[model samples]
Target: MKTIIGNDGARPVNSTKILSPVPPASTLTIDHVSIKIVCQYGKLQMAKISRSSDTAHVTYLTPEGLKEARAELEFLKNEKRAQVADRIQKARELGDVTENAEYDAALDEQTLIENRIIYLEDVLRSAKVISHPSGSDFVVIGSTVKVEMDGEVDEFTIVGKMEANPGKKRISNESPVGQALLGAKFGDVVEVSTPIVRYKVKVLQIK
Candidate 1:
């Protein structure tokens, strides 16, 4: 058994299993601690934590994001589950499942659906809805920011990892640029570091 402590030193979390192996004395940030109930075992289990990034332990979502997640979960549990079950039933009626390709595929699809459902459930359970930043003093999650890099100005909305879509100009708060922009105020230049390149972006505006 290993005990996980919060970053704030609030309390110790006891876990019977360590999802991602780390040194016994390794310190984890608050973003790495995840507590979720396992439907299979009917017990709470600490989820795997990645060494590089936050892995959905404390999912941050905007109100719209939360609603979207809920709608998807409902569809998966209700419509998608029933559709897969029907496919399985039809496939089972065809012949022996041991050699039936349709049956095998249906079963595989069912497993994927179940896995997605579990993930969504865990995310929703641990979700923390982020509101629009109350002030423009500093960049925070849910803040729309305008920045200048390489003498070119660009705008981005800081969102959770789940809602991140670079093509859509929505960036994840955990992303290199996003992380660098966080806590930066207008007129502040912040350096974004990545393995490939490092550049500085000046915060021109925050909304």
Candidate 2:
């Protein structure tokens, strides 16, 4: 028996097996069987048998983003890890660890650093670097787009989710505006819809 859990409720099936060729971002377990499901940008795709421990997913990154992640991972694994270890050792020398606030704080910081190191390692392992767009004929992952909406002109670069910073005019390709602008050409108008509002923007340039 296989069961699917969703917003509506749980639905069960008999004499059926679920399988997904590619692993997704999330998993669901039913009847001791693990199924992979992809949930991104408010969309969901379910099906694929795998162990719950298998949590690898493709991380999209630009060339610079990939370099930054690599640098961070290197620093964490080499310098930061040793620094935390030294702190823990120094704290341990300061009497009973059970009652030592410095020891506890160092341990906490060590945990955080280790967790980040693991995350960055995983990201690096599963990264897919976005290639530079050719000619900017149409919007792509690395395109810097100029747009006009509500009589105001704005510019932003479309990057992977990991490098997205709205404050810096860098938006994720998965975002509503980026999705709408993708495949649009210069002087083309596109509709951007979000839960909060729906509006139109005209593509003024693509770089």
Candidate 3:
């Protein structure tokens, strides 16, 4: 198997120098990666990348994404509220609230529902939505790359966390294949290693 050495930008760069694969095998280090969230049209998107800092950055959704999140949260909250109200009314008709099993159960349900609503709201507030950059060239997001390996051809799209799925070959930018192909040009050879197998991949097309 062939090994592709990483370049650290010095002239005739240290070809002999190799970085020991970190344990836990993260595909890419999100050093100084910035995250943002936004919503557009009706779809929500999340974006992330390694920035020029010592930490990782990630971004997600647009205004549209936030709207969708809010809608779902509202639905859940309202449904729970109605259920609790009905339970309380029924318990009141049974006479004593202090001894009513239905009243206690209804209160417990309300408490759980409220907790879930708060949890969802917190997650939405912290989510970073990806904003599609105009003229985003070089496989930033939503770009499909076609590759060839040992005469076998395959295609993959590098996408956000929500869209990443291996079953459809829609890989995350943080995956082995995706990381190996980032910034690569057509006809260039790349090496990718996973727990099961290693790949000698060639770029046939980038779109």
Candidate 4:
């Protein structure tokens, strides 16, 4: 909304759209400047975060998990997309789109497919293929931990949220139990607290 004047005392036509005054493109470095296109949503152009972000926001995945995510994304794009498009075309032949139930359902399915494709793309982009590391000193993202609670021994792999399936002996690193177990070693007693219940777990093993 403000005018950006260059050294020549005239607004640079190409950069006038910039909301804030930026020096000439030659003066701005990759680290100093974040180019944003003036679009519908103002998407960042070629944005790159630090490595810490890559690790912190990273989705830890086994080789198998990574393969599955890619497969699902490809299937949705290559197979489901065409199917939805075909359905929509046929539904459009039925009548007006506003009153057509088949058209609406097909459109909904297309939206879901597209959304899932986007999700999978993000996931794969940020994915870190981590095999379960071998360590007995402390628990980490790829560690399988065994804990004793109330005379019962439960073993579960501590994994990122994307690959967690508690019923299959896999738990999310964000979970209370998983968070508490991280960096805990054998014979260390850790307390796990939830809104509904509180309990303690003694570390039995880590692998």
Best by lDDT, which number?
2
lDDT of 2 by residue, 93-176 (tens): 999664578877876777677667766776777889998776878999889999999999999999988899999999998999
TM-score of each prediction: 0.72, 0.69, 0.45, 0.71
lDDT of 3 by residue, 27-118 (tens): 34344443333222221222222233333445344455567667878888778578777887888799865456776676666656665665
The per-prediction CA RMSD against the true structure, in angstroms, equals 15.1, 15.1, 22.8, 11.2
lDDT of 1 by residue, 104-194 (tens): 6776687677767877877788799999986669999999999999999999999999999999999999999999999999899999999
Q: Which candidate is the best by TM-score?
A: 1
lDDT of 4 at 132: 74
lDDT of each: 0.79, 0.80, 0.62, 0.75
Clashing pairs in 2: 19-48, 20-48
Deviating ranges (above 4 Å) for candidate 1: 1-56
| lDDT per residue as tens, model 4, 2-34 | 455678785535543433443322222244332
Candidate 2 residues lying further than 4 Å off, grouped into runs, are 1-56
